[model samples]
Target: MPPGITTLAADAPTLSAANTGFMLICSALVMLMTPALAFFYGGMVRVKSTLNMLMMSFISLGIVTILWVLYGFSLTFGTDAGSVIGWSQDFLGLSGIGVNELWDGTTIPVYVFAVFQLMFAVLTPALISGALADRVKFTSWALFITLWVTVVYFPVAHWVWGSGGWLAELGVIDFAGGTAVHINAGAAALGVIVVIGKRVGFKKDPMRPHSLPLVMLGAALLWFGWFGFNAGSWLGNDDGVGAVMFVNTQVATAAAMLAWLGYEKLRHGSFTTLGAASGAVAGLVAITPAGGAVSPLGAIAVGAVAGVVCAMAVGLKYKLGYDDSLDVVGVHLVGGVIGSLLVGFFATGGVQSDAKGLFYGGGLDQLGKQAVGVFAVLAYSLVVSAVLALLVDRTLGMRVDEDDEISGIDQVEHAETAYDFSGAGGGAAPRATASAPGTPAAPTNKKVDA
Candidate 1:
């Protein structure tokens, strides 16, 4: 127990129990986001499409877990080749790594790192399901995601985070995944929407969510899980940068929620639960990239701007004549761009990287880098996703038939219903409940007494 000897030993890096435990908890929290996403999108669709919507997000957990274990992780993080993609398949199916294998400089095992990233792989494609709500074929969507992650997401993940990645080489910063996850998925969603066409009823039909409470619940779950999503990207328990990320995640999200409410009240003369949930999500997406770099006040500005811009952007689908079913293009695409760009202006040298944004006297250096990353992912995703969607549509059929669509995708696609408006008995079952004003009545065999 010599003092100098102990000091020397302490200086040497060793296994960290605190960091390991932190990553594990963060991994689990991120895992919850998928199911939470299911609920979020599920509640926003028609009652007839509830199960189908849930299944879309739920299916990703199953599909991506197996895929990531098989080779998804390898292609994304393996030995980098030419800085565009990872080349080694040594870790496929969790094979090459050993029991004592640690992730580079960290005490966390490679397996822990693998599974933590797997949650991200699962969630990215699921984000697109919201845009295609109430229309796409379940089987087609299943296949499309499988192809998409392999072709689009994996490579893009490398470009942003992998060793020797071009973007990494250029000093581009994406602490979480504004480019890889939100912008990528958002662009891909718009691509698929273009190929698949609109929901059966576009401008004419009054389509609304079946359950606002459920939407609120899902948003709450997303906000809860987002702590892991944003903060866990740091992958350690350092109180300095990690703590700042945690605070910024919360601050930005709260500001965005309030900003959205204010915008709603001013424009529509009413604040809505849907606006609150959507704004919170917009905040979450915007902060995902900038949280690690910006101050708390900076985060507030990012979130508030995103909240207002996205709220207004959602209406673009209507004006532009594109059928974006759930405002994915609006919220995710616009919000992601806002966050990514703001990082160029708001980034501080002390937080994580030495890169300072324009406002911090770094000039437009980081801003230009951010723009390149943003549009690069957006363009690549948009083109590739469109091609993939068209291929799926041509070969296997992307949308359900008109008859099945009108009959409710739940019963038509899954042979199950979310809510049985037409109970069991044919003659006396409760159905339609007076049509709920603008909504069409639920079809039932029972005759109503006029």
Candidate 2:
């Protein structure tokens, strides 16, 4: 080989393969979250639609992955375009983008970062599906996710993470995904539940989950992978990445867990396993935005407060008569807003160069900024989500046929059972087979009166 050629190769801004490896691992770690989400959400629903709930999160693995590779990444993190959306410079393909080439100034490969973020994009919308569980049509849901992602998820992601996004330009500190992932998912969930209507017997039915163990497993995976989700935002293991975010993650989650259990005991008279899992998730959501900003003490406060607030918020479904079946709006949206606003009051000295909170003596200026960020995200998400819901309802339709829903999405939509007590061939006892082998049974085309 020519010496000149070797010199050129060395000089090229190629990311060291080692760095690429780390990022790919991180990406994989992040991707694991979607399935974990399936388990988390699947275990929360009634046994009838359990498989449908799990599939809701699982389908994202297939759908969003394709979208991200095609154009989702470009629309989100492409070059600086406008406060509204990104340009198509990254169109058709990831052309000119090299594995190992850094994004902005980060040490990891841009591809690695893109794929990792892809997992988050896949999971965020899946989170909303839980709100309308057991009642939505499988085909309608497939169509809805496709359309919703193109309109709502993509634009919101661009605004928060993309350079040209308005929120990014405003210096709002969303360290992880307070506004983008949690708030966006939460608001969309609320819109979906309202539009789809409630479950058949929402208030009166004993809708407890069938599998607490699965819920525990899902929550554990989520808590574990969250380190990558949040810490990996740094894009590399460089600097004090291990110390700062790690401590914040641990402390906040623990505090939130205790706070949630404590509240459950105080109010409901029993500290249930469900509350434990929910509390952990609440802490994770609360700390997502604030973890990189607040101190350990701040994280503790944030987590504890989030646990109590979300616990209270979960009951709103009963009060308002909106069936947010899985508490997506309650835990994620409410928790996200709490953390986002609290950071304005608790943000002292952490990773990003943001203002201090009220406790840190920064006063109302930062708090107001936090409020602006929260309300802007909430209002935008709600309006756009509602509009998108209306579009899907009109175009591809939204809710499932009433009979299909009453019979259960797992039996009607997927044609597969969540469990096989009979241990028949190929798993569960063979029920009536439907279209698409191994696919869940879908609803028959008989429409119910809207």
Candidate 3:
């Protein structure tokens, strides 16, 4: 155990087999979300940039995992230095932690808890990649994730979740990470997009996804992994709060999917698969911060509102002239705000009786607190992320050149492609003759037996 840390007394049951197992499983589930997100964002961009899109998320797992174990955990969860940030060096590399030492309020090992939160650290910045897709330099993005996580994500996480952090002391109610994760990443995306500028053809090109099936598959994985993301946040199975959160997550996602489809039919005259997947994600984001506090009915309200509002919000990029290629700003920023704020109004004294919402007779007090947390994170993340992106842009460069953007970021940055259409997958598509890079393919007119 660390010098000042406390744990369950040795006389009492020190470890619960069930809770440890549950947390381990939950950690694994959250780990899968990064790759799941890679697929989710991967299938949304044009095929030329798909591999690069996947890499943007995949690289976070490598970068942030190292940083987290080194000092990230210490800065976010260590003893408070000034009520704004945790001890920056105490838990470096998680040193001085014992395998049997238990985390407070639970029987699980501290290692289990540390790794679980590490997964959140990994996924948060990857969430921003979708907005800047098709245009960023992979090296610059990697560097930005390093600096941003250190400066922005780590300190904000401390403020929201650490014991003496101001937000935790101020009655903020982020059961999960409406403030730290979603809102942080979403607002950061907007900041970077301002500097990254538009893709080659902001609204002029028909940049339809190359594969809807891939998008659907990725969404399915995200839905599966989110159970652990939202529910396992409780850190123990003994509390019934996890169960309520689980059910709320499901219902809210289902409601959001339907709401999005309905909005599409009313506005565009057709229901689309993309709408269904995006709506489900919108619902997932909406319930993440509120699920532990709201009743099932409240969840339905939140999901429906997010589905409709986010469906409308995605169009803002076009009208406002900022290009968010994958709608991260709309889905995450808008959905996160909806979830965080609605908790102020929909909280039903579910988790804590004193945390009732306005309709529950708690009045507008909680609503105002929620607004403070939401906008505080929004403003801080937006400003810091923009400064980081701009600094990286000036020093190391940020966006790829126009030619690379047009041809394909996959080959330009990563030296690979997502698909090889030259009959590589047991198909009979003709292989092009070696010639100039942009030459048209020769057609075959030879007769062949059926």
Candidate 4:
């Protein structure tokens, strides 16, 4: 996130116990986000698909951790290879680095940095699960994560954060992961959904969320954990840049939530719980890349804009005839682009770097640079992820059979359902019914709320 310290003190870099401890706590906070996301996404799908939705997010923790230890860290943070990737023999298997050896230019150990970054790697793939919920095969989704991270995530992480990375060298300002994580995952979600096709009876079914409380709980946890996610990206608090990021994160999220609720009230005539949770997330994504560089007031503008924009963008799937199950492309992809590009207008040139935004008299140069970073990651992740999804679909089969999907993906894929009603009736388990009241008995060409 912070990449590396840009300016060193007079003394040579040495280990700081304070920084190491702080980073360890931050890593744990970030690790909690994947499961929190599981709950958030899990509650948004039909009851029959709840467990499948949760598993899609949870599995990334297991898959990415093993991969990160083996080669993820090396390729992401190792020595630059042609400004496209990284390589380091010592970082292989994480076997060669000493406990006391610090990440270059920082006080924390290389292990600390690696683990911190690993949490990001794990969460990015999990973010895509929301888009493909209720229809994908469990094993096939696992296979996709395995191949996608190896082919797409790892190299992109290097390009954005690694030493001598082309984007970093070009002076693009991404304090966190607006490009590498959110846009990368959002674009991938678009690609996969394009190949996998829509869920059965997508627009015809009401498909209301089965558990709003779970979604709220998940959103609360994500908000708490995101403090660590944003502030800790600065690596340390010695110079107080992390503190500024912390404050900006809170300000922007609050603004986004309020803005989203307002928009929902105006457009839909009701402020739904889903809108609040989504707005909070939109704010979080919008401020991630710009927090360190923008003022607190600037964060509010960014969050408010992203909240209204993403709230409106979520309806595009319906208008365009693409079924993004949980609005991944709308929220993450659009929010990430807002945050990354706004840096060109809001960057103060006093906190993270000397480059000023257009609003600050730096002209259109930085904005142009930001656009290159955003679109490059978008195009690459979109094209590559589509190819990978197609490969998986053609071989292992990405979507379940139409009948299985109609019945329930959870029971078909995992033999478990989110809710069991056998004890209530002393009979076989009850099939999942539409949770929302007054849902139609049969599919119809009725308009459904997004």
Best by lDDT: 4
What TM-score does candidate 1 reach? 0.91
TM-score of 2: 0.89
Q: Model 2 off-target regions past 4 Å? A: 1-19, 424-450
| Per-model TM values vs. the true structure | 0.91, 0.89, 0.92, 0.92
Q: Rate the local accuracy (lDDT) of all candidates.
A: 0.91, 0.82, 0.92, 0.94
User: lDDT at 316 for candidate 2?
Assistant: 93
Write one digit per residue (lDDT tens) for candidate 3, span 1-450.
Answer: 569876555655478889999999988999999999999899998999999999999999999999998999999999997888887454799987887888876789989999999999999999999999899999999999999999999999999988789888888888778889999999999999998899998788998888888899999999999999999999988869898999999999999999999999999999998999999999999999899999999999999999999999999998999999999999999999999999889999857346989988889988998999999999999999999999999999999999999999999999999988777577576665686788776767968999
Where model 1 places Cα greater than 4 Å from the true spot, the runs are 1-12, 421-450
Model 4 spans with C-alpha error above 4 angstroms = 1-10, 424-450
User: 385, model 3: CA deviation in Å?
Assistant: 0.3
Model 2 accuracy (lDDT, Cα): 0.82
Writing each residue's lDDT as its tens digit, candidate 1 over 1-450 gives 346655464665566788888888999999999999999999999888999999999999999888888889988999998888886667887888887677875667787888888999999999999999888899999999999999999999999998888888887889889999999999999999889898888998878999999999999999999999888888787557888999999999999999999999999999999999999999999999999999999999999999999999999999998999889999999999999999999998879888999999999999999999999999999999999999999999999998888788999889998887675775843543555678876766657699
Give residue 372's error in model 3 in angstroms: 0.5
TM-score ranking from best to worst?
4, 3, 1, 2
TM-score of 4: 0.92
| Colliding pairs, model 4 | none
Clashes of each: 0, 12, 0, 0
> How big is the positional error of residue 373 in model 4, measured in Å on the Cα after superposition?
0.4
Model 3 spans with C-alpha error above 4 angstroms: 1-13, 88-90, 423-450
In candidate 1, which residue pairs clash? Answer: none
